[model samples]
Target: MRKLDNNEDGNFNKKISNSPANKRINLRENPYVARIRDETESMRAYINYETAKEQVRRIDDAKDLCDEIKKMSEDLNSNFYSNLEISNSFGDIHLEDIPDGLRGSVKYIADNTGWSYLSVLLFVLLSIAAATRGRYIAKINDEWLEAITLYVIVCAESGNMKSNLLKLVMRPHESFENRKQAQHAEKLSKSNNVDIVIAREIALKQSQKNHGKDLVICKEALKTLANNVRHDRNMINDYCPVEEASALPRVFTEDTSFPKLYATMQDNGGGSTFASAEGNTFLHLVLASRSPLDIFTKAHGYEKFITETKRDGTKILQQPFLNIGIVVNPDIARQLYSNDRLGLHGLSPRFAVCFGGKQDEIVEDNSSKSDYNSYSEKIENLLEDNFTQEPSRKLIEIQFSPEAKEQLLIILKETEKEQNRTPKGQTHYRAYLRKIRGLVARIATILHIWGHAKPDNHFVSKNDVLIAKKIVYSISLHAEYAFSANGLSAYYDAQKILDWIKRHRHSFFTSTQVAKGIEKMKNDNIFPALDALEKLNIIRQLITPSKPRLCVVHKNFITSA
Candidate 1:
């Protein structure tokens, strides 16, 4: 995310086209550094010159380690799935497995733009589920263990056609809802018995306690009634938000204030999706909030969440039905990753993150708006087909086949073992494996429903589970990419110092000279950063009887930078 000036581009890490496969090749021609660049091209990612060099070196080191693991796993078990050959790209999704009508459009858009097919395809799928989250929870034990709600994020540059692609994907869903909300509102407006009076806010338990009656029974009855009433409402994503003193309907909000979003969800049915391309807006909201998003974290586990707001003296026993999708930059990605480390509930980790970069300039040939409509309409049509019974419809329980469970168990065991062998600081993101199993199950159920993969019994089959594995593996790679990108931000200052050292050609510089180079370097971190640079072999330290202790920049760093 660092801005590169023209002068800086001379040795700016031999940049590559930012695709998921991320084909390692320099953007501009450079005959002098071509040999080293070509040698490192296949392994390095687009990062600071030194960091990318370090990454290439580390990758070279890991090849031997991977070889060791391969040998060990082969000796222990031949069916080990995580290997170099299989770890090709983020993941490969068979277009045939995708629900009909989605593959063509998603692929078309991705192909036309500099976006990955998997990234675009997954975005469309998650958005579909997001549009239809409420009234349709995928169940595993007939008890709705799988939330069916999803949170996915893809980080890319602004010019990467993120907004355009989203607009095309979202068009049909929004259009369908706009029409449905109109019809529902019109019908309600015409109704004579519709409740126009606002309900008074008084705790029934307090009243029952005052009356010397059983408060528990009263609260229980209230809870049931509240749930029933909320369910009975026409809960669909409303484009126009309701005004103050009016009931706020369900909405697919983008970059909204949490408090307003929270209130809107409560008014509608305590479920909503926040899908946004402008990720910084949400970051700004979180930073400006009175407290961090506890609801978001609690929602992941569907924990016993309660919110009592002082503004309206309102209390809500919030449900864990919220979904989110956002496109973010590296700065916000770093911030979210850091915040995830700070909290016990861990809002940031709950999100399934994917990263994207600029791809080759796509063919100028474009798809028409109507073509976009055709794909989004397929999603809308599927949503209607799933929830045909409009008013009082409920989620259908889709059980997993017995064999599916066995397959899932095997995947879980292998994934956990693989994670155990992961290098330190990288495996922290694997903690979400506790939830990912259920998430994969939910996605399988969703795919079954969407694809209409007709089976003898109303249960998810092994085929569905297999598809889920591919999806989950892809998601894991994305999580690794995103979290790793954020980790690089911690060394931002160090990378800057490296750049300075390489540029200034300092063979032997004192602390005072370092001060002259960087007038405002952190007093405490300068020495540690220098030590780190030395450890990375980007620089070396020397001490002599005739001279003060001085640091010398590595000779190759100048070329590499």
Candidate 2:
């Protein structure tokens, strides 16, 4: 080997293989230089190819990471129930546990739709309440209660068939309204004809008097005729007023503004239901209006809601009853329950919350069509028995049995104890406990109506109370998970911390490291994130006394990193 010139050796790496300056080099003057130059060019080409290949690999890796982050975000939004310890602790609501009149329907609906029994049961209860809201009120322990109403939220991912569930449960109401609207149209047409005839008669009498030669006689006959016409008009008005036909009774709406909801309830015989598959969208639409949360609170308590709108003028809804049943994803549920205003304003406490189960968890179909038909018939029967097109309507009163009353007292005491033990700052927890008594009563009332054809003047049995308590307690577990900030919030924080760990290739680190590294990660958020990661076995914390606290990322996680 011969030593090359320093200038050539130094400039070789800086020069492109295809450059004009390199092509002009006198390689043929020495065979050794030509051989060396050829080898150098080949090596440069190899290096460039390998560098490009590595960059492509990095891009593929980045795409995979992006896909993973997107999937995680979706899971965090939709399937948070799977990771929630509260949902894990909750067992299924048995078919036997459901009210006898509704068990077959619950089973049928669950089988047909592949929805969980718990979700079906909730919808069933809400449907019954919506159908019978203005027609049946309960009296438990001498407390006069208006119709059984509930505020509910069902959390699930997309393609969970929530809309199908809602439609099935509300089928009876839909049928009832369609029939009523048709009947109303016919009656209104007839009423309009009667008004037309009366108007023609009055006009004829006035014209006859105007053209009469004997004014005195004509006036007397016209006054008598006018008196007769007025009497007939009064009788027709008393019999069937046009006001009833102006707007047919509405049982529920999928979505509406506050003013529209109020007007709908007014036209719906002082009660209305809000049911929707897209709960988040419905909530966002309504919550943007003024004081909608307050109106909802009032409606939950069956208080009077008086509002003034430019179009409707002053509208008063006495004993306004609202039953809400909506399905949403976990992200929306977290936003709703974590809102301080909603929690403190008593709207959050009125709701019973539950999350959907995994797709593979759907139970088998053992229910018969006859059983479902029986349930359907019962709902129609209730509608026919309670709902009427009459201008004046009545509500049947329900009472509780002595034993059931005793059970309710126990529930009351338990709720009071729980409330008293709750921390001061935890207003949502305290309010939820405080409201459990009424909730149980309402549930019991709905169940009581299910079994008996005539729920009026009948006492709710202890069995009903037990079943209601079971359902309430089961749903309350999920509600607790929903109201906690640590549920979804902690999951997101854990994701951030995990991503940081992977990016930095940290096998072991401390909370301080995470807090200092990630943006917007406060000390308050660090512990929950660590706890979540630990729960997933992605990391571990050391207990030894040391200068700095330490955590160990799992070997599996580090290997992936």
Candidate 3:
């Protein structure tokens, strides 16, 4: 009878292999077998359903079988199939025999549930254990082998699971056995760090092939696995691969020894090395450092120490580190260092050393005195030897109106009084005025080139001098001929005067025109004010046109004013 039953079983298996529904039913009897059968059937259905309609119902049946198979697989132990060579015999069934509909259903179930069963089971057991110690376990089979099977599944499917599994394990549970299993599972997940990494690599490859839609799913799986591992302290410290944990996406282990990592990063040449490993380059690792000082120090040290160039011609040292924070005080630096060495990881000794120095003293002491002396000598030589010819001076006539002339005299007297009131012993005061005059002369020449008259240069008002100084400083700061609208207007007026002289061949404005122009200018209050220009010898009155007479309309007058 036993031999007959065996023969019948063999025949039934053969018939099931040829029949889609029968095959799915047989697979649903064993969880592992059911999972594989569901996946295979679904994949086949998906491939064939595109061409056939009758296969859709079969696909739905296959999906039902897959779910049933997954539940059984989670519930069953290896002993349930100990007598059967399940792994070897399971592969012999022809998935093509399954109807397209059943195959599609199976594939969907497998794709979604195959990797997540263990995580779900663990989460349930953990939750139950938290509520009632023996009540949950006593109600179900507390088989060790069954639990281990679930553990293996958790590790294998870590890449596909959710981070919630981690939280579940970390939560307090009543059963010590359940807690131990959770802890073990968590550790295994972390230790299997390479699984998610491989998943990510596969995802990236898929993305490169224009399969970006699959990237999010793959990335989520990888993140889930990493989070599960990070939730348990024991798992984090023991089973988690320090290097691989560091490599995992979103795995932030602050306790990592960055200095040690940096030292490991250093090449034989004393420079930082960006050696390639497991899809990440040394440059990638260095760039991942969160400590600014660690980043800076590593970057600077890498540049100082590393010698190899990447395929793209970028040196390892060239990679920038992220999460940089400025060290304001050494006290802060010391505190950061004491609390966490990684916090101080990227700072350079030079930066920390110079943080306390006086800005002015540092600048003065660092400047080369010999270089300054050489520069001064070059300037004196240029002034004396090269500039031997006097600058051509055009005489400008100035016959200010009675009111304008009176205003000029009053301004001049005020300036002279201020000069006299300045401390007599202060040579710097005199030097400052001379500097101002020189700046005004140069500014006027520039204005003439741009076709404008010099604006008011009177220093009688401190505010006026400050405005002028700002203009000069602005030009110097930019190292270019930058001027405001007012400065441009002044330049245009000076150029007009130059143009007038060139066009007239030494003619000057008549006294009435001069008076009218001055009166109009006074009303506008454009700078350098007329009085200031005359005082600086930028424009003066000519005594004569032929003999250079001191007449308001004379060429000398025009040139000097």
Candidate 4:
């Protein structure tokens, strides 16, 4: 009976293999199989690299160490992430530890956003976490209470639901504005406009003259006046009145000048979020006006930012609280970082970046509209509950427990090793590593608030520390991959070798066959080049543990042929 079953199974498989649908696999034309086959080639790439390294060592070359360095760089550029999958490199950890109130909503959006919901959640929570900026502090040790505020970047491609998620999660800020506007209209309806204009002029003059405590009185007077008389076309940096500026009435903005940002934070008591769904929306403006970067880099923490304007040498002092999130796709990322200004200016190190491949397809949800509505409502409720907290009440501080402190140090040391192991020419990698430990601390604070709605706890728990480390590790890996995307053009040279395999019309080929087919490529470069092409999923090798490996062309081998 077993023999008969085996024979039947083998004949059934043989019939399927000879079918028309399966014929494309033989021609290497089916993309789905091509993707699965790429994973196998990835392994061959690592083996080839090791084999080449061994051979390179055994050779007594006339070339010096500099020549070897150049060759090594070329090899790394061609097969950057082939050896390790960035997705699973960090291993797994528990991601279901979201606050019970927000869990269903988080999962609902995660189902449809076409983004890693975890990534989306991190961005969303950090935006909301801005409220806890100076209100709650952390004690790493016995010395001081550390203010925890993390700034994150969602580096995803366009049309990946970044904007939709931002719109959905950021509803409370808009709601708050609408509520406030109604209140303002009721109070200031019959106020005189001439009095307001006179008040603003007096306030500006007094601010310039005294730079003193009386400026507060002047600021408030101007704010009341400005609110009564609305100006649609307000000047840059002059958009908000000095008094009402920092305490932002409108919390979320896609476009804002540095002065406007400063005013928002100031009015909001030094705590607010600035988020850009598309990276290019603000980056182009930022790059053109370079001075804002200096202020933003320091304002993420409690440190005071003193910016001196070139226009009139006006000095602006701010000890503001700011949390910024930028969603950058590959095209914008390359353009932003390639100029080297952000790195050179020492600002790139401040952000905790979430970058990698974004989802290309949307996940379909067949759930009823009520289910979706309930999810959005829960998220809004979470934000509303937090936002409506007593603005004038005493609040307790948050800290890391002794064990959590030790755990944090261990994670810092792990990051330190990564910093040291980073190779030369990738100096920005070392620069960005400086902020990882700090970011971990801030993320721990976020989790603490997220897991427990109220800040009743004194110390961060062991679970929070564990989750924070996982977030850091993932971001660091993606950062390395994102910054190194520039060197990938070297992989294009592998196309010549792939074309040669196609021209021969052989089902399988050996190194000799490749050599015979390629009339132009030099003998010395052939093997190393073939190794790179294989790594890039341009070709594959049929595995035979006891026999010589045979070359199998990738399904898209003749793409440029």
Candidate 5:
């Protein structure tokens, strides 16, 4: 204001502003301001440069990370390619990692319409590839194609494409519209063909873990498959193992003849049945002999026989008639009886009036006493004749009493003399006597019990009784001789009766007596002797009877006498 300078006047003066030289000088002198300005400029320059450098560094790091990722991807690609190559070499598709085209086709058909372009394209490509590979494509009909397509779709949807393909290969003729349709179709298939169908159905139903619904579907499918492939040939009865089929016990009826029974056995492939050959039915044979059910069971396959019953309700011993009798072999009887023991009670008595035993009394009285007298005589005669003749012969004659008894005594005395000559003669003699006495007592007891009363007042009945008594006495005498001759007394001497019997059968005993003796000997431990006697034709065991029946050795006795 004092000088009226332009610089001070309304800021219009440029010449009055501080000079650059002066400001520079002033700035230099004031280090704080100068340093602040310098730092600010330097900071601006540094910020610009740092920004550019950071961008370069970021680009470099990104490029390195990308390279690492790319290398890893290459390694994965190589492994995948190697697995594909391995699969192709094997001519089998890796179902777990199926080709894109096949997978796409299957998926398309399963969820979408069969008209999926992707599926069609895949099918065409696969067909071409198969042809190029010299693999024959199955000539499938339109229906088959549709079914295959549907099956593939189901397989794809179920996530078991591999197994489904295997099923298709196994059963080329099989086809289905969908999984459900396939399952239904499988049921109609033959049993032999069911394997493939079942596999496919299982695959369709398979989840993370198999469960109830899957199991049910699988079972049904398997059953259906079985039906489709079942063999239609009739079961071969001829070749069918007899033991496996028709092995059921057969009960022969009274009306059934031997030839018919034999034929029946043959037809069923000839096997041992429980029924006895003595009569048509098991009960008949058992009743006729009054055999212990236990002894009857030891015969081959007797256990199976007892399971069957006769038409008559009679069993082995359940009947009133049978109740009085004691089973000699309870073990065998129980086996033969099985559950059918009570069924024997209904059988009719197989009695017939025969000549010889108290005929007049039997005719006049027709009483139980007369019946017993007749039966005793018949049985006694049968036993005597059976002892005298070979197994081939039919029993016909009975022996006289005194002669039979004397002959038996002579045989016994001779055997005793021979046994006493041995070092342990006394011991052998006592043991043998005990065995013979035991046998005689048992036989006597059985006879006395069976033949206690006379038939009736009839003289004819008395005559039969005498004859029966004589026959039994003779048999007992022979049994005595047999035991003594076989050195049965040697048990006390520590020498087996069986050993002596084997060595002396030909020298000391007649073939007839030997045969009878061997059977009696069986009550003791005389298996070796029995076997030897059988081999020598001194005795033969008739297996047809419930109890093994003894017969003489000679064929001539059987044929001539």
Candidate 6:
């Protein structure tokens, strides 16, 4: 309590600080101890500063991580939406997608038969072409393109009313064939009278001739020969002078041998459709041969070629147009895709395919009962024009307008880019891209005829090309899907997965969970199917601490369910 000198108080403070209990109170009072404590205090301040700095750095790191995650989520959403836009389903083609001229037929057939609009559209196009092939050609720029012909394969399961669909669409064609065959029968009977006269005259002359003398020396025989020459003046082979009766007129054949197909083509004057509801039967007939794609490729291009047979010697084909339209099961289509020869020989590229998906129930509309009458009338008119026109007249050439040509050029450029982007493994699909230009032009030509009142005078408009591109885009996507290694099998598995998800009402699931949920499906099947759905933007994967392989179903898919 008494005041003291600095040295005395410092000694006292030191003594007090030396005692452990009083150090807290007296340490600051001793100058030496206070200096030592200040050094320790500075070190503690440095450690506190370092710890605070580390915490601030961690906070900044966490901010960066949050931003990275946000960017990734945005990127994923962008890609998912982009893919959805790029790869639209075949059933995505709506009424607006079809041209006004053909929309009625397409919708009618689709509604009645439960076929996809794309399927019915392709069939109608093929039917029109089959009815009028060789009557019209397209002049796209300098290229003299052949008539609109297609090798279309609609992949669907059985009991899809393919036969009824075919019968309805081909009614006009069948009617024309029937009428022609009737005419042919009447003509054949009259022609047989001439044949009988010739045969009787020849028999009489031969009976009159002596065995020892030359048969030609007889005056009566010479007279009969001259009479026979007069009767031989009948025309055949599209108006070539011949003695034989004319071959039965035909537009298409369902079941025929390869050699017989060519014979029919000859009879029809170089155009025919090898169409069938049972496509596997047609496939088996065509593919039975070692080199099946040869004639098909040649005919598709309307190329001239000569084929020799054992009895017929050399048969020359002038300009053959072969259109094949078939409805096959998805399994058969996969077999076609897997055929190395078909793909490599370019037949696969020539085909336009449509995979039939889930069909909606058929709802009968009384208003549309007579919708097919207009279609039939148009088809019959085309057929009449083809048959009534002079054989000597050349094909009516369909040209494109300037705007259409520009649109086509744009499409060609885009196709080139697509070709460049296509992987090497997809050789046939790349070839398919290469063939798109011709395909578009052919479709445009057909659309021009279907859309215009006077197709012979009018040119293919830019709108025609745009519609053609829309159709071709859908078709190309289908081709890409079919050509993929997974193909229709993956599509099937994807449907199964969707069904299972719907049954169990799964909002989030793993591959293992899906595999377990699906009956008779192997674990290997789950990944590809899930991947397909993911690509389609139906579901997406999530990573979390609790669930590593978690996938959330798309809100749209869930709501639709």
The digit string of per-residue lDDT tens for model 1 on 185-236 reads: 7655654222331221223333334444342457777786566444433231
Q: Clashes in candidate 1: how many?
A: 0
Candidate 5 accuracy as TM-score: 0.16
Candidates' C-alpha lDDT = 0.59, 0.73, 0.30, 0.58, 0.29, 0.74
For each candidate in turn, the TM-score is 0.60, 0.70, 0.16, 0.59, 0.16, 0.67
The per-prediction CA RMSD against the true structure, in angstroms, equals 26.1, 13.6, 49.7, 25.4, 46.9, 15.6
User: Which regions of candidate 6 fall more than 4 Å away from where they truly are?
Assistant: 1-89, 144-146, 190-244, 388-393, 489-561
| Model 1 TM-score on a 0 to 1 scale | 0.60
Tell me the tens digit of each residue's lDDT in model 2 across 1-561. Answer: 988799888787667766877766745666888889899999999999999999999999879756654444334322122232222235778778887777778888888788778988898898888777666777874555745788888887666777888887888778887887888788878766776667656765654554443535577777876676676657645654544347766666654566676667776667677888878656675456355575687777667778877886987766777789998866576677777778877887788887864333455565556787776677777776666433235656788889998998999998888777767777786788877878888899899888777777578999989999999988877766666555555655776787798899986787788878998888678777777776666666544454335576666566656
Instruction: Give one digit per residue, the lDDT tens place, for model 3 in 339-410.
Output: 323322322111211111111111223233443233233323322221111112122211113433344344
lDDT of 2 at 356: 68
Model 4: per-residue lDDT, tens digit, 176-262? 657765665644543434556566676565544443334346777668555433332143126333333113254554445766655
lDDT of 5: 0.29
Candidate 4 accuracy as lDDT:
0.58
**Stretches of candidate 5 exceeding 4 Å from the true structure:** 1-217, 228-468, 484-561
- In model 6, the Cα lDDT at residue 71 comes to 52
Candidate 1 Cα misplacement greater than 4 A, ranges: 1-101, 142-144, 180-250, 287-292, 301-304, 317-320, 340-343, 364-374, 382-393, 423-427, 453-457, 484-487, 490-561
Better of 1 and 2 by lDDT: 2
How good is model 2 by TM-score?
A: 0.70
Q: What is candidate 2's CA lDDT for residue 330?
A: 60
Model 2, 299: alpha-carbon shift in Å?
2.1
What C-alpha lDDT, on a 0 to 100 scale, does residue 268 get in candidate 1?
50
The TM-score, computed over Cα atoms with residue i paired to residue i, of candidate 4 is 0.59
- The digit string of per-residue lDDT tens for model 5 on 76-185 reads 22111111000001011222332332343333232222222222222322222111111111111222110000001100111223232322221211121133235434
lDDT of 2 at 352: 86
